[model samples]
Target: MCSNLQKAMIDLIEVFHSYSGKEGDKYKLSKEELKTLLQNELSGLMAESKDPAVVDKIMTDLDENQDGEVDFQEFVVLVAAVVVACHTFFEDLDKGNVTPCSRS
Candidate 1:
């Protein structure tokens, strides 16, 4: 069985490929492109904290090496975090621990 982390990584890759319109493009992402993509496609997932400060803090925290942007590895980490958050949220719902709600 694939670990949750591994599954999350796979899901992230699928999302990235879809966003880039290059499902087969495994090429490295430029810093600017990465930032833009994250801000656009990942805003909702990352914004779940309902706090801009928290979201910004998470973004900065993932930008390791102080490069002012995220690389593939860093992006993977960010996606993994989002995936975990999503999984936990769903799991809570499954257990009837969370109110039934939809973002849309």
Candidate 2:
């Protein structure tokens, strides 16, 4: 049986592959694919940002080779960055440095 972390890793691979290979490339994500993946899989994360250009910004930042597509390596960097950001948010919340809810 795989550990939880192993399962998570597998799921990430599965999720990436599910969205990828649907268009022109079998191993990379085109801009549209990335946008779909973000909107469908990471809706909450995407919803946090108000800027309409957020997806464009993310695509540019993640397409490290300037190939107009995001490969697995580039995708991993994005996952890591997002995970780090989430961890930092939780850490801050745990330390009471950030407000969890501001009741009106």
Candidate 3:
């Protein structure tokens, strides 16, 4: 049986592949693919951003190789960062530094 962590890793790879290879470079995510992935899979994150150029900014930051596309390594960096951010948010919430109802 796959452990929960293993399953999560598989899901991450699967999700990346599902959104990649549609336009160019079967192993990398094009800007459009990244945009679609963000809109569909990370809608909450996307919605939380007020900047209209958020996608562009993310692309610039994530394309570490200046390749104009996000490969699995770069993609993993983004996922890790988000996971850490969520962990921090929850830690803050637990410490009463963040109110859960602040959004509502």
Candidate 4:
């Protein structure tokens, strides 16, 4: 059985791959491809202020080896960061600290 973290990482990778019509294939996303995917697929999930720069920053931070691309492991770390940020945002909302609104 995989650990929780391992499972979450796999799930994130599957999501990334599924969007590319290449699920369960041996593939690693180049920087530009990953940026496009994140912008198109994750924009709704992220803040309205999210743009290419935001994605680039994320890629830079997560691409630990400075490879200018993200492997599955790097993508997993990126997903985890987003998950944590979202959780914190929701927790703040639940505390009556902030109101949530749709960007559109």
Model 3 agreement with the true structure over 1-104: per-residue lDDT tens digits: 99999999999999999999999999999999999999999998898899999999999999999999999999999999999999999999999998875466
In model 4, where do residues sit more than 4 Å from their true spots? 1-11, 19-26, 45-47, 50-52
Best lDDT among the predictions, by candidate number? 3
Q: Which stretches of candidate 2 lie above 4 Å from their native place?
A: 101-104
User: lDDT of each structure?
Assistant: 0.65, 0.93, 0.95, 0.71
TM-score of each: 0.57, 0.92, 0.95, 0.70
lDDT of 1: 0.65
Residue-level lDDT for 69 in candidate 2: 96
Q: Give a tens-digit lDDT track for model 4, residues 1-104.
A: 99998997677667777654333334666766776777677867645763648767777887798866677777778777778998999999899897888534
- Name the best candidate (by TM-score): 3
> Candidate 2, clashing residue pairs?
none
lDDT tens per residue, model 2, 51-88: 99998999999998999999988999999999999899
Candidate number with the higher lDDT (2 or 4) = 2
Candidate 4 residue 11 C-alpha distance from true site, Å: 4.2
- Of 1 and 4, the candidate ahead on lDDT is 4
Better of 1 and 3 by TM-score: 3
